[model samples]
Target: MSASSSRPSYAAVLRLSHARRTFGAALLGRLSYGTVSLAMMLAVNRATGSYVVAGTVMALFGVMSVLLSPARAALVDRYGPRRALGPMAMSYASLLAVLAAVSWRPGAPVALVAGAAVAAGACTPPLGPTMRAVWGEVVRDKALLQRAYGLDGVAEEVLFVSGPLVVGGLLRFAPPAAGVALSAVLVASGTLAFVSSPVVRGVRPTPAVKSARRPRGGRALLQPVVVAGGVGLSLGAVDLLVVAFAEQRHHGDDVVAWVLAALSAGSALGGLLNGAFEWRTNARVRLPLLAAGLGLALAAAGLAPGLLALTVAVACAGLFVAPALTTAYLIADESAPPGFRTQAGAWVNTAVNAGGSAGAATVGLLVTHAPLGLCFALAGTVALLAAAVPAGSRMPTPTTA
Candidate 1:
């Protein structure tokens, strides 16, 4: 095939009937995922009148989701997303609805609400990872396949950037229970449709390839996966640092909004533009450089003279965000064993979350005692450490043509 055959425009990728259908359904499935936490915390706090109780529920949810993600993805690996998505979507949504109702009732037990929240998280459909897994099947061209991964990273960032605002805004006019109910409905219906799509229905899990020559033990997560998560941890730290910076200046939420928006816009642009050009750099070399670049950017953010300068610095740093993330996905997909592709994707998700937790905890504890720059430095240092992990490890190359 000609090289041109491998590189379709974004419009072309979405224009394929199957691709179009799949994207639409996936969008709905995702609409609530990023926002659900806000919804849950609000309802729980309102019902319990205690931040401690609310926080506990949210923490448990996070823990359950991380622990269960691999198993859920493995189910998709064995049964196909078509079968796996439904039970998860329905069960998760139903559990959320029950939680919302419990929160609404004045006398509902806190433990009951917590249990439902835990179940909802454990039941999260492998929507994001599965979509990425299927793209390998849908797009035949290696170049286009790479681009698709970039696009998926950008889409996921969109959720992170917008999810809180959307959930918060809706919660303003509606009750917390209403917000959660809506979230449940959206995730359920969207995932249902996503699984029902002809294109999605046809995608099967990657079968484990066999080779006695290849060394094997317990697999999926390894050094590369840790580095992949480091990307998230670093970002999460920078995120909180930006908020602290804004608070330090007494600029409040408005400034914080500007700071995050700049980062978001830069990341979106970088992801779109990166795929347009192929790099001469090897994946091993490219991955670490991009990750370390984030550290440098975080440092720059700390050094900016003022708010305007910080915004510019953050946007510059944001430019590297998507490229680094895209590389992480490429690494995970390339590094894992065959039967473990879906499970590998789950590991990446776990790493990111685990990293975020570490970042948030470390920064939250230290930010009050140290200078904002110190916190930023800590975040930068963590990312650099993450970069080294992958640099020291071995990752097999692309198996594709």
Candidate 2:
């Protein structure tokens, strides 16, 4: 066959275009969310005169997001990306504005802040799952999708690392209100850009089959969908542990940036490698290896006696990060019913976030009572345990319904 004949057909071109648009939307959504999160932390901290209070507010935001994320995902599955993305973006912006106003007032009521946090959480755009579903539609090749995920992972790391620094600087040099206003601007700019994209504009919700009914009990938990959620939770916990370890070691301020950078860098490398491979491996092999590697790295980091050793160890831990996550993504994709693809993706994200929250809470307590090394060891052990979960169970069957 001629090279041209082997090349992606005209259909592939259209798909690529759609993928590009979806990626743009995802990037913008992440940027906006990151900015708001950073600014909110600073604003709350300044207003309450306590980091603990600020953290509580942040925790509330997480809880709200986790609780509502499934519903938002369902909305996307039911109503399509356009309908879900636009309204959620607007709501998020409005919430941020309200939060800013509340912060601007001296001694603003705690109840008011708490209420806004809940609202903000509930309004979070279902970007991760929605974008994943969009990508699935646009990218016909599995390898290409993996690359896209790697890029997405990198973008998230950049956003989180940079967002806080920007907010911190604004809070220090400009008024606290300035940071809040800047956050609002970021959200509006990013979210609006995403909603207006042609790809998003063209998306239509798939029609649900009228004969389909939800699956029953224990069988449901064993489904690939549930397993994917579990994987997400594990990943989230790893993230939280990283932060907690940094804080305990007096490296909290800069360590987050470094650790995330390392992980993103590793994931980017993995993506490139994934694209090069023409063959596939079983999750059975991939998950355990990645998890074991990560576990060892974290344990090594905990045992490190100096900053240099700690940095090296963390970077090593990051080496397996992408492969493990990609495995979870693939599992979820293969397992979900067509209409629930978006929701499945969101569930994975929610699990990760919830797991991270739990890890943070656990490490916070451990740091106070135990050695920092122990905290790191605990994270590694949990990751190792996560590796075992998939091994003991039968591989999830692909959904046909």
Candidate 3:
């Protein structure tokens, strides 16, 4: 592949035919993912009057969502997104509506609520994976693809940060169930719009095309999956650890939210800046260094003497988060067998969610028993070890399907 005469701007990525319309619709659908968890948790807690039951229900939802993701994406790989995504979005939306109705009033049956949640999770659309697949299909230039991925990553960061706030605003005049219903509308409508795009409809399934110079089999995915898991693990630990730190210092719980917001701000900035440059090294070489940088920043966050210092340290850690995840996605895209790009991306998604769940559970238990600094160190060590995982050899000739 030959380099372009000049760097491709992110605006150029959007200027591609149908890029804005397709990407906008996909983001609208993906925002449902950002909002659903908080809405469902709140609805479940209100109905059950027991935090334990709510937590258990959420755990079941999350587990099903994470475990079935690759299978859902495989459907997209096998049948093309136009055929595969519509049914998934509709089914997921219907189930969410059912969940909202069941939890609208107190004394809802626990079995019914739990069953509805599980069903909804199983049907959740593979919009994120499908969108990345679309990006790969529409954007031929590697540099422009990098910008597209970076833009996507930064927008996702903003969505997650704003999602809970959206729920909070809804609670002012409506029940949490209303938020759930709104999520259903967002996915169904957005997906309907997404599949209607001419570019999206043109993405047909293709058989795997082998390249001898590229690494074969699932082994190629090992580094990105492991490193993504490490990033997720450290991030999961950060929430609880930050709260604990705030409490220990006699600060209000609200401080935790502000600190986390700082982290997101840094991530958005990092992603934008990362996308704006052209690097001599490929993603395989850049990924491990990004992971190590995150690990070091997190480890140092533990030693901050004041809230301001801790926030700054966390923000620095945030600098690596989006770029690392973007690089992981790029690697996944490059490593995917010709027909399996959606599944390849989904595998990384699963690893991140599973690792986050494990990290939260493990750190929740350890935070009570260990020193704060030790807990932070332990969390950071997971990423450091993952960074040490050799990134494997560079592709002699990188190829995209």
Candidate 4:
């Protein structure tokens, strides 16, 4: 047979199509989630005149989402993405609308705020799991799968960086209420789009074999999968330190926004590079080195002076961010039992979010009583320590079929 004839033909084209659709769905979901998140934070802060309260609300949202994520993922696994998206979107919109209404009313009860926070948290759409499951189904090639994940990671960074800016602009130039309303509309529309896509619609839940029963909590949190969760916690600490450091330097409250954007832009660049490179090293080796590099770069940022210096340092720190994240995803995918993949992913995400909250709260206290630079130094030091932990240990092999 001719070499050309031996190569796969239409199958390659079909895979590309599926990848494109998956990317689109991810993009829309992220954009919607980011926008609403930004708007909600801004609105809550404005209404309450207390960032502490706003932070509490945000934390509650994260906590609830984390706690319920597995359940949400289970819903998707059982009924598919189409059925899950509709209720999630509607619930999300309704909750936001109620929040807006309560905020507008004079002397709104604290209960209203608490209720809003819980509702918002509970209704987070199963975007991450759904997209991940789709990728698992559609992309058969390992390299292509990695590239797709890199792209998704980059997209997430972009959404977080840009989404807030958009909300801020709307709230500043237009009306705050308008921003909230816009967020609701975007989220609902995006959810609808994701559900309606043929690729998403066609994804049926795989039959669970007897061996793949639901895992007990302790067992699930053990294993290399949990180690990956630790890595996420380390990253979260790094992020918190970056923000606290920026705030301490009198870079303004929005300094976090700028630094985040710079870091995200670097991560996006890293993702693209990850796609282009054909690395010969195993993930275990590459991931630790990458994480260590990130730690060193973050340390440099802690020692740097001024916004420009900090920005450069942040960007450099971000160079390894996406690679480390991709590595975590790969590990989680490999280590998780078949039926528990969604829960595994959720646990990773929850650990990251929880770690971030802890880091931020801790750093905030340190900065309040101690020097700002000290807070940055501590954060950088912790990150470096975290990076070293994985490096010193024997790396696990990537599991395969």
What lDDT does the true structure give each of the candidates?
A: 0.77, 0.64, 0.87, 0.64
Model 1 ranges with Cα > 4 A deviation: 1-6, 105-107, 206-223, 390-401
Assess candidate 1 and give its lDDT.
Answer: 0.77
Supply candidate 4's per-residue lDDT for 205.
59
Kindly indicate the candidate among 2 and 3 with the higher TM-score. Answer: 3
Please give each candidate's TM-score.
0.91, 0.82, 0.95, 0.82
Q: lDDT score of model 3? A: 0.87
Instruction: Please give the lDDT score at residue 181 for candidate 3.
Output: 91
**Candidate 2, superposed: residue stretches over 4 Å from native:** 1-15, 210-264, 271-279, 283-285, 391-401
Model 1: weakest 10-residue lDDT segment is: 212-221
lDDT of 3 by residue, 127-180 (tens): 987898888777778888899889999988988888888888999998888889
Kindly list the per-residue Cα lDDT of model 4 for residues 1-401, writing each as its tens digit: 11121223333323465455556656776686677666766667766766887778877877887777767776776667787778987898778778877765335566787688688789887677667667656666666666666766777778877777788788667645456667667777777877777777777755445455423222323333333444454456656666666555666767777777788788788876775466788665676577667767776776777888888988887777777766666555544555555555555566556656666666656666766556555655655555454423332221211
Q: Going through the candidates in order, what is the number of backbone clashes in each?
A: 1, 1, 0, 0
Clashing residue pairs found in predicted model 3: none
Over 1-27, each residue of candidate 2 has an lDDT whose tens digit, in order, gives 011212333333324654555566577
Candidate 1 lDDT, tens digit per residue, 191-282?
A: 98888888877777555555411544223235557676777788778778988888888887988888889988888888888765576686
Mark the 10 consecutive residues where model 4 has the least summed lDDT: 1-10
